[model samples]
Target: MAHTPFKSVGMVGLGKMGGAMAKALVSQGTKVFAFDPNLKETSVEGVTLVSTLETLASEAGIIVIAVKPNLVEPVLAEFQKPAIFVSIAAGISYSQLVAKTPQGSTCVRVMPNLPLVANRGAMGYFCEDQAVAHVERLFYGLGDSFRVTKESLMDAVTGLSGSGPAYVLTFLQAMAEGGLQEGLSYEESLGLAMETIEGTLVYFRQLRRKDQNLHPMEVRNWVTSPGGTTIHGLDALERGGFSTAVRDAIRRATERSKELGKG
Candidate 1:
């Protein structure tokens, strides 16, 4: 068996990401003491749902603050004990977290996406130097967890990977619609679109780390020939401002993250 930093953890909120993480953690043989104001996301089999934050804190030495950005403050206030904090609140900064917790506390500011529910997610974090391995251990089996050299870059991670899955889903919807327009049933088109995107990602991942891998554009160009069907589709996407809109979405999210950190 692998070494774990802590076998018991306290989850302060059990919303979407929180609940998924709790399930995943318990699946990895960790005991989770979860507390949610609304008593939601407490139904996962292995999770021991506590009625109060104090009850949760009493049992777990490492705590995960899985609340929203706006709710993080009050939630942090309730954690009267000194413990390792793994906060997944988007837009919250490292300084903000350390400020809210007990003095000399350790906190990791994490930005994990919705895909974590499926256990195939991107988990980006920035933490105190001493907490690196401990933080990684918290998310070890849950996703592709990694740390950033600087805390400021977490905003970019939030903008890109944190919000990226939605963009992919949006593109998938458009692909399904395009097939529907061409007379294919919506269900069939959507199924085909899903498989295509999944297959493409698998292929890209296979070659992405090769010693002499080409740029993504080169791979894209290989699929697109002069005046070919693929090029025509690409041209249509360009004319429709697909690239610009996607870039704007990431930019806007990043800016919002910066604004949130200001608080």
Candidate 2:
């Protein structure tokens, strides 16, 4: 069954990610509501602050469980009514959400990166049925979403898109520092690094539009000449274990996500 965009959404916690989603939803003109025990009054403009979890649950047709993984159960215990629950808590599985919520409720496990705050995020979600439509409705204003067939695959998403931004930022900073070694001012180095990345992304996007694979090696070879600066730079990166370090980072993060899901 097709579902129209929902007119309202609610959140349980107003922390960093939750607050960001709230702002996005509000910007889209959806009536937003939130409840956080720590907050004495409404801290976010255009969002109604409710006093109790039960009230938020009952009033919101689709309630986002934005609290931490440890807090999920206790919050679920407080809500006896059936409501579509979209959980952004890391490591909280679809089964856990279903088991915790009331019968007839829909559950969606979404892994959203930090950039959702800027409404330009890459999000992944898993659900058994059309319940994910509710997720799509709420996330319409936030960012693009990828749906995983199996819930367990969400861990891979966690390891990739979920943690990809931080990794990219680290590389960007390192690239800037590399320019600093060439006597470029910090500000100029950073600006050029950002533009280079952005331009490369644009080129890749154009290739994608034409159904071409982003063969990174093809692009690299295009830029490299015999005994060229690019080759020397590549050699330096390989010698520094950069490739291994990146692969290991993802591997370790995926393993940690699996452990977290087990909880």
Off by over 4 Å in 2: 1-4
Which pairs, if any, clash in model 2? none
Poorly placed runs, candidate 1 (over 4 Å): 1-5
Q: Candidate 1 lDDT (Cα, whole model)?
A: 0.88
Best by TM-score: 1
Worst 10 residues of 1 by lDDT: 207-216
Q: lDDT for every model?
A: 0.88, 0.86
lDDT of 1 by residue, 117-166 (tens): 99988989998789988877888777798789999899999999999998
Please write out the lDDT profile of model 2 over residues 1-263, one tens digit for every residue.
55355688889999988999888787777888899998887667899998987778766889998998889978887888898889998788888899999999888999999889889889999996778667777888677999999887888888888888889999999999989999999999999999999899888778778877768788779999999998998999999999999888888887888998788
- Clash pairs, candidate 1, are none
